[model samples]
Target: MAAPMKFHSLADKIVRTRVSSTLNKDVKQFGKKHLFDGDEETCWNSDQGSPQWIILEFSESLSVSQLDIQFQGGFVGKSCWVEAVKSGEESFARIHSFFPQDINQTQVFPLPDTDSTLTSLKIVFDSSTDFFGRITIYKLDVLGAS
Candidate 1:
């Protein structure tokens, strides 16, 4: 094909990403697709539970530089782990860990060393700001290239 078109937002055309849970399937309010739709109003709200996760896979190995995320204030992934499965690796590596504050604003995480010439990228939510353990991800755009 045409080299798959170099992408800026890795989640833009997600074909193989996996999510732990979605808040409501019937209302179509909080599905995982909203995480990268480039819309601030939409989001992926995980069901009430701890340790929720989302795995974003690439068509091939690609370089990742950073992560831009927006989370709902009260329902944030407070303690989280960012992992990656590299080009030749079989197991996922714990590339980074972060603690997102409880605020409804865009948070930028520059993975300067975390390159993701990766086979897949994963985000595991170890804890949430919400008492019910919910996570609402407003945006999930990865700055990367093929």
Candidate 2:
């Protein structure tokens, strides 16, 4: 059997910042404060309810084996969608989506094969009620590759 691919931390791979709120001066300023050079920004209405998202972009290609999403509170929707994109030009593809029963709790998602390369990462909100109201993520850790 092939040995497991090595994993790396995404602590330094943050390349851009995106939120679900209206793009006002505050949001733009927030982007300027968090996003890196050549990063993209966008917003989406939550079909479920009030939505929140944290999008990250890696600087280099790496083998992603696991993903750790650390947030302050829990979500209200039935499930959340995690997406990845190979390049800024490519459209985001769904990686994982699931419902959580807990609130105000930290969540961890173990990814599938996910050998695919990613330049950007996004967390989608899917809920009926705005439990958290807005998704706020403190940090994201992508495991695999340096």
Best by lDDT: 1
- Superposed by TM-score, candidate 1 places the C-alpha of residue 33 at a distance from the truth, in angstroms, of 1.0
The C-alpha stretches of model 1 lying farther than 4 A from their native spots are: 1-7, 112-116
For every model shown, what is its TM-score relative to the native structure?
Answer: 0.86, 0.62
- Per-residue CA lDDT of model 2 for 32-113, tens digit only, reads 2432222223222222235556566677754466665444344344467788886434778888885644454445567766
What does candidate 1's lDDT look like per residue over 33-131, in tens digits?
787778878889888888899998888787887788899899988888889988889989899888887888899776746533787889899999899
TM-score, cand. 1 vs. native: 0.86
User: What's model 1's overall lDDT?
Assistant: 0.81
- lDDT minimum window of 10 residues, candidate 2: 38-47
